[model samples]
Target: MENLTLEMSKNTNTLQEQQLKLIEGNFTKSEALKIINNVVNVKINFHKLQRLSKIEGNVNDKCTYDNSRISELIDDQADMKSFLRSLEVNGKNIKISSTINITVEE
Candidate 1:
C-alpha cells in the first residue's frame, strides 16, 4: 500500500509538472481546465483507494502518512482548478474584446 501511494504521488507530481508546462505555453482555457480536471480526478481516486486499503488493514503508518499527502494534493488540485477556470474565463473575455477591437479597426 505504501508503494502504491508513493507511485500515485509520483504520477500526480508528473501531471502537475505537465500542467505547469501547459501554462507556459499558449494552451486554450478549455485545454487547461481539462488537464486540471484530470489531476483532481486522479487525486480523488487515489484517496479512495488509500482509504480502502486502510480499512482492509493492509496499510501501515507509512501509508497513513502518504494518505495525508494525498489529501494535501487534492486540496492543491482543487485550488489550482478554480484558479485555472477563472483565468480561462478572463482570457476568453480579453480575446473576444481584442477581436472586436480589431474588427472595428478594420
Candidate 2:
C-alpha cells in the first residue's frame, strides 16, 4: 500500500510537471492531452483529467484565499441607520451625535 501511494505521488508529480508546460489559455481535452503527451511519456486518461481538475480547484482556492476583499465583502451591509431621537434636551430639541458607515473599502 505504501509503495502504491508513493508511486502515485511520483506519477502525480510527473503529470504536474507536464501540465505546467501547457500554453497559457483554454484548450479542449484532446488539445490538453496532446500538450501533456508531448512532454510526458506515460499513460493518459480520465484519471489525469480528474486529477488536473483537482489541481485547478487548489489553484482557485489559493486565489480566493489571497483575495482579502472578497472575505471583507461577505459581512457587507447595504446601509446603516442610527436610532432616531425626537425628544427635547437642555430645553431645546437636539439631535445627538451620530454616525453611519454606509460603505467600507480598504
* Top-TM-score candidate index: 1
Backbone clashes per model, in order? 0, 0
* Model 2 segments more than 4 A misplaced: 1-22, 42-106
In model 1, the Cα lDDT at residue 94 comes to 18
lDDT of 2 by residue, 3-88 (tens): 11111112343333321111344333333334334423232333355455655846545422233333333222111111112222
What residue runs in model 1 are displaced by over 4 Å at the alpha carbon? Answer: 1-26, 57-67, 88-106
Question: Model 2, 36: alpha-carbon shift in Å?
Answer: 0.8
Clashing pairs in 1: none
Q: Which whole-number lDDT from 0 to 100 does residue 4 have in model 1? A: 12
The global C-alpha lDDT for each of the candidates, from Candidate 1 onward, is 0.50, 0.31
